[model samples]
Target chain A: MSQLTPVATTWVNGQVADNLPVTDRGLAYGDGLFETLRASHGSLPLLSLHLERLQRGCSALRIPFQGERIEAELNMAASVVGDGVVKLVLTRGSGQRGYAMPVDAVPTRILAISPLPVYPADRRDGIRLYSCATRLSDQPLLAGIKHLNRLDQVLARSEWQDPAFAEGLVCDQQGQVIECTMSNLFARVDGQWVTPDLGRCGVQGVMREYLLARLVERGEPAAVSRLGLGALHEADQVLCCNSLIGVWPVVRLGDRVWQVGDETRLLQSLAEQVYQ
Target chain B: MSQLTPVATTWVNGQVADNLPVTDRGLAYGDGLFETLRASHGSLPLLSLHLERLQRGCSALRIPFQGERIEAELNMAASVVGDGVVKLVLTRGSGQRGYAMPVDAVPTRILAISPLPVYPADRRDGIRLYSCATRLSDQPLLAGIKHLNRLDQVLARSEWQDPAFAEGLVCDQQGQVIECTMSNLFARVDGQWVTPDLGRCGVQGVMREYLLARLVERGEPAAVSRLGLGALHEADQVLCCNSLIGVWPVVRLGDRVWQVGDETRLLQSLAEQVYQ
Candidate 1:
């Protein structure tokens, strides 16, 4: 009933049907990949970046992704929706109850564009983060891919109901800060821009990928590392970034606090440029 | 399109709708619990066991579950689709795009019935198992519940396309044998029936719960432990079970083979009776 109030346009497998077959593997087994791309003035600003990530995710999940079709669809969707977030869901489609993949799997392509969520103005000043008790389980095989199986993130996000707690930081089993409930994390420690390594768990968001490369291109010492709480405490700055939000300066994380630093501001501006 | 054959009746949230809203959280984030029950002469024998597991799973996931509505629905489904399989899917329903639960989540109830799949005559003898390379990720929070997030089993089952191999046995990251892709596993190691502990990962199947209880009642020691490949190889007999396939002796797992032992045979008979 809640989802009945469709906020944006939706297309399923090139058709405008929002009702999917119940047997779709994406529902039965969460066998799929998804990408959330930012649209600006009828064009996907980071189309290539999102498509690249989606392709890699498809390869890892063995979901046959038709890149050309998706690119065309995204462009069409961007032109239609204009300014919002475009969501593309690629699933292995319907299958029998058994876990075995159907001999001839027809992948399902779902494209939806929704109005960008309005963030509170305080978020720009940097939002408060809750250290979620719901830990991200180490799954090296499924790590870094934005697969539909996101119960960990769902559970982590469910931890706090307060609006003040804009996000939650989740750790892997080994106590390494992997990511926020919805974004990838980075902290400047000892003059190095270190993002959490997603080799074990967490999604390497498209924005995070872009910013990491941008930092390196600027001749900044940027690298992926297994970050811990201590790293945040010792860092000069901490921030979280995602395609939808661009970059948010995490000024407060429970008891630990950090002022928005120059590196974070530069990255934010660079990310906004890229997102634009 | 293959699923359009409507061999079974389907009802979505009290309405006879075969198609589900694509926005269903079950499809979105795998936020759901499901039960597949075997019906004999229009009656579900192990309804309590299945319902109990579903309840527990819903509770763990923080999804609202209405037992009374489901019980009435099951009875209605049982009468309509006599002597077949009754499937129940409980999803957090559709919601806004985010991990946060809907302020008012009207959980979706999906009921479908399908004709019981035919098994080969040789199935009574035993089946060979494949040791899949895809390992089940360790997530104690999601362990034991047959949630919609089943990509691990899907990947594992995809490892072997050979129909000769009935199922694939999966392991946790620690290399401990967990369960078959579609069923629970048990091995008579050192004269005790030991099922792999689902403390880390794996679905605690309905048939497994019944078999374990029955085995204990008969004074045949049955327990759960962190089972390893070595333990299975050293076992006198190994077997797999599910609600649909009562109990089948696992005569082969890779190169390690074993005869259908007395314990397995006895359990098979008892399980068959329960299934009937």
Candidate 2:
């Protein structure tokens, strides 16, 4: 028999509850945005980065953002979570059965905490990536923001179930590599770090943003390039990152093989200094 | 100063409840499907067509299809609504915080009934269509099925607020006319019927399917063509159709104007016989 797992504790609109009204537009039409944060020692290290993305998403979608109230709730949840993951879902709330915005709409905020995921011990050193057949749709309007309409990512993630493949590598319709199912990708091509351009498709991760900023601060800025599979295969090193899993070096993808290079280690150490 | 409107009656998993567990994948990632049906005289006329599409969607998404149970629930909801609308939402249900499908996901079914929406009397004669700036993303994996990841439609619908424009015309990123915000489009160009090809994007509506079949039965099948705005401008007649709205002839789009043509009348009559 399987052991009982610790259930997630959730709050809806600052009230402790585990259910949402079925009419909430988040479920009705995926009219919402979400942020997944890592809580460390009762504090969120990159709270500002997450909020910036959330604020941008809300503004783009025309949803009212109550930042002060949301931050207060997030702080409370982070204190309870200590060293786990905190997810925030903001929806346009319930509306009449229509696509038009409700004039008097109140936004719904859901904050929850779940136990930290356990990964293979060696996964930190390197992981294999599965090439997903599900290509990312090129909609610049919805690109680079973490929104609730993520069925594309869901479908890509579903393509592989083997534990050996840590994540799936996704591409756009034009066969250009975009990002992984749940992380952003970076490649070291010809001694220069290059990450895929997310202007057309892909969710921009906070960790990727932080790393890019850090790289810039150190005077070794990474280029945002349009990378195809050929460029990825020819790269000296490959790495993937997100808020949850700071950085994981990709050692193998199909016939291509890579060693955890010095650049990868340096980025991992930088992430460790902050995440730890 | 405002009169109270009749609230929708909802049933979740066969129970009279209006809330769902917050962990549902549908709310988390929009991993679900939905159908909006028009009920008349205590019955759903287009039930079979809706289910056929739902079945195809569930199969494509790897979700379990509980056909009989859903049919029963739809019947119950239709009886209560009598002459209104019935909406069904089927989600992959609650899951752990990840994109990977839970091995044993119990699908969640939500059935609700609301009063019929009322439009202007002149809307039936013709309505203007706003050319939306929001372009549909091209993803064949999620195309042609009414999956719940509909943020594109939500954004397109939000573009215009003019009462004169009843719906918005959405095109794909390639500048091909796809569909309206909430309905499928058909145009008569050079004495031949043409509809936008949905192999790349746009939802394949049940009403669209019904009309296509009806046209085929009359030996005048609509061509599934890749129609650009140029072709649309040259069309003799343009029509939009959905389950609730039945059929509406487009009267105007910007500088271009159209009258209710004879072909549009034929399709309207076909929809009327069943919807009435």
Candidate 3:
């Protein structure tokens, strides 16, 4: 048996450890929130933004947040790998087998560092998208936050094995376009940028939120609009983005193909300034 | 510092361990299947049924099934606690940070034993139901299996703190009644026993399946029907059932109220024969 290097720094009650107690609610009910970030030269450019999102998620879920300890763990993870990906998981800790959160339970924090994923060379050129049939549920309470409950994405990703299809576009139960399986989607409609409103469904991706801010700063009119399937056919440009992968333009959606547009390229360059 | 007994018996590749390696996919994305069984005198009634469901879920998700080892571990868990609730968790095991399932992953198994949760004294009399605003997603692939992704139920359950309201009834995005937060729902409509079809949404509860089979064997036709909020309101009687709770009649649903019915009592007696 090969010994695996300690990839995670786990904290139970303020002290960092190598493992979590078996009853962690994170492992049980997936009672947790995770943040995946790209680190460059032992520092994360959007570290504060990532933490802000994590805090917001915690607040929404009623999970207690320990920002100082989480920051310490992040530093420890970054120190191990100067330039890599750092994944932070905060769980409600161990509890009895019931659904009720333990009254005085201390939350568990886990931070893991790994080598950065190798992005496709053609990612810069643009990516091809598949319109998946799997639809996201509309749960306003759980919307707009990154949580551990991601079965919808897993099922959608499992639908195809063709490496050529970079990602799949997922719609809501109402047949409204929501997002890609892993990334938030944006489209250029009539020379203006528009993205789906995640208030009802889909995750409000960190990078997408950042890009929207950049678009506003550049004096570009970007709207949080509810997209229909017909809108994709009429769009000038389509793109997908997440925190890890800054931004990727969509060159094709099923049979319809479009050349990479200037707006997509501009957003990519702006996100790259912070991501790389 | 005080030491607490571990609530779970964890196994990694056949050896007993408390903490799963930080790379467990269950922790990363909730990539897992779970079976909760009632154990009496070190023997589980309907063990085969639970195993069949687990195997079916694993096959559906393309996770490798190791039935022999699972049975052995379950036997070990049964030996630890002669009578209680036994929960079996099978995760896709450890993998690098990504959604792609590893080609060769030894699935991680967790066996936890907990005392049976105490039910409210009047549960046999009836339970008050709350109409939840959280809508269930229409995903056929995940509808019937008890997978680990359950954020929707968690959020719905968190919506209320009133002990009078036993459980919440959820609906689909189209406003069709689906199931309760953690249990399958049934109603008496037009002198027929009808339960919401799980082909589009909701987890197929093991007890619900068992009761349906018993009803059929007794020459009673229990239809798997699609229900709407209006249908539920018009029902003569309503009940909920799961592995943990044999059967609970609904006494009140907002302004509408139901009384304990003959069919509910008969199903409860049948479940008791198997559980007790």
Candidate 4:
């Protein structure tokens, strides 16, 4: 229980609380969405992007989104945390036993702040990835949303326990590299930087979106296409990105190794600015 | 929230509580399994079958099972609620933020009882099913277990609001009829009783397992095979079964219709005895 006390402060539905009702649909049926943002200097740098995705998830799942209230809460939590991580979990709220949607649903909002995880300082330079056996199921309707139905990710993350591997790489049923267990993947294959298309599966990570937008602004948008595991192995450089970790260039995977490329360094430089 | 007050009693890990810690892995990543058993005369008639499935689910998900503690808590709750539905949710307990399995997870067991729902008495005679647009994803790793990651069923159940439809028929990605939103399907096609194989998707209901075991004992084992919508439409009779609902004779689906056949009535009689 002591190890679980990593959360610095918590708020539930605008009130400070560390417990949710047993009947919350999020815990019952995973009927919810979530956003994990990096807090820096009493502010969430990518709050707008995370909120945009949260709103889209709420719309798709038909859970009422409280945009203004959520924004206010995030800002308040960010101020308290100062420099850490803020996680927002919005659920369809408490419902009677069954799958049917409750008409007068009062959505549950959980906001928690935790000290930023201290990773190896050299992780930014390079990190190794474990190839996970768990395959991401293709559900187009739920694709790209940071929904609470994340057992797939949980299962994948459980495949490895070695500290050497910072994360695990996962693929779909057809062996198409989807994304890492915790981060979105980008690989420079044949001189073109590409990220997996998440229309079929995988969460459209906030940092991945930020990077793509940054690339577009510089008129060198990365290609969003399917990359097979074999092609990924032959790639010049591979990298994984997420809000918390910023970006980690892949230096070793199985039997292959690669030095960080110039483009990866550029991406890392941009990430450093946002995470500063 | 009055409708949500249907629960008669609630117990958390043998103690009466309606709230759980916000950091529970069950709410965080849906890292848990659940069982919904029917309570009759201060006892669960199919407790053994339910526990068997629970043990199997926990083993598959790697969540430690406290068999005796759970059984004791279930019995205690059943005695209190007598004739009703008892839901048991077992989670990997609280953990530090992330998907990694906690080394010393104290599994959370939530046992809740609700009064028997007052459905139309004539519903046992016949019921209609909605054809849901939501397709179950093919995740072999998670197939046939009633895990907390049930957004697919939640989405399917939300497709219709018609009270006339007792349940919804869902299929896999390849259009193979899997099961109903909340029950297991059994149909007699070409004079052969068959239920969809849940190797790729859907929950394997306790009632379905019990019925199959009974059939095997009687030397008339039902074949578990892949069923498509087209073949299902031409079936002689269609039925759905669950612990609480017993067995429901599906009388209508889309333009197709069926009658409460002799075999269905026989199964219903068996169910009546268990639920009596």
Model 4 lDDT, residue A231, Cα: 91
Q: What TM-score is obtained for chain B in each of the predicted models?
A: 0.95, 0.96, 0.94, 0.96
Model 1 preserves the real interface contacts to a fraction of 0.81
TM-score against truth, every candidate: 0.96, 0.97, 0.91, 0.97
Clashing pairs in 4: none
The lDDT per prediction is 0.86, 0.90, 0.81, 0.90
lDDT of 1 by residue, A1-276 (tens): 122123448888877767899888898889998888888888987788888888888988888879998898888887777788889889998877777778789999988888889998778669889989998877888899989998998899988998888899999987888999999888998888999889878998989988878877888858798787887789889998998898899998878778998889998899888645
- Give candidate 2's TM-score: 0.97
Candidate 2's C-alpha runs over 4 A off are A1-8, B1-8
- Stretches of candidate 3 exceeding 4 Å from the true structure: A1-16, B1-13
Q: Fraction of true contacts kept, per model?
A: 0.81, 0.84, 0.51, 0.80
The two-chain DockQ for each candidate, comma-separated, is: 0.79, 0.80, 0.50, 0.81
Q: Best candidate per DockQ, number?
A: 4
lDDT of 3 by residue, A145-176 (tens): 88887777777887778888888999987889
- Which scores better on TM-score, 2 or 3? 2
Span of 10 residues, lowest total lDDT, candidate 4 chain A: A1-10
A101, model 4: CA deviation in Å?
A: 0.8
Query: Which window of 10 residues has the lowest lDDT sum in candidate 1 chain A?
Result: A1-10
Interface C-alpha RMSD after superposing true interface residues, each candidate, one decimal: 0.8, 0.7, 2.0, 0.7
The ten-residue window of minimal lDDT in model 3 chain A covers A1-10
Q: Cα lDDT for residue A147, model 3?
A: 85
C-alpha RMSD of each candidate structure in angstroms: 3.5, 4.3, 4.1, 3.6
Error of 4 at A29 (Å): 0.6
- Residue A23 of model 2, lDDT score: 92
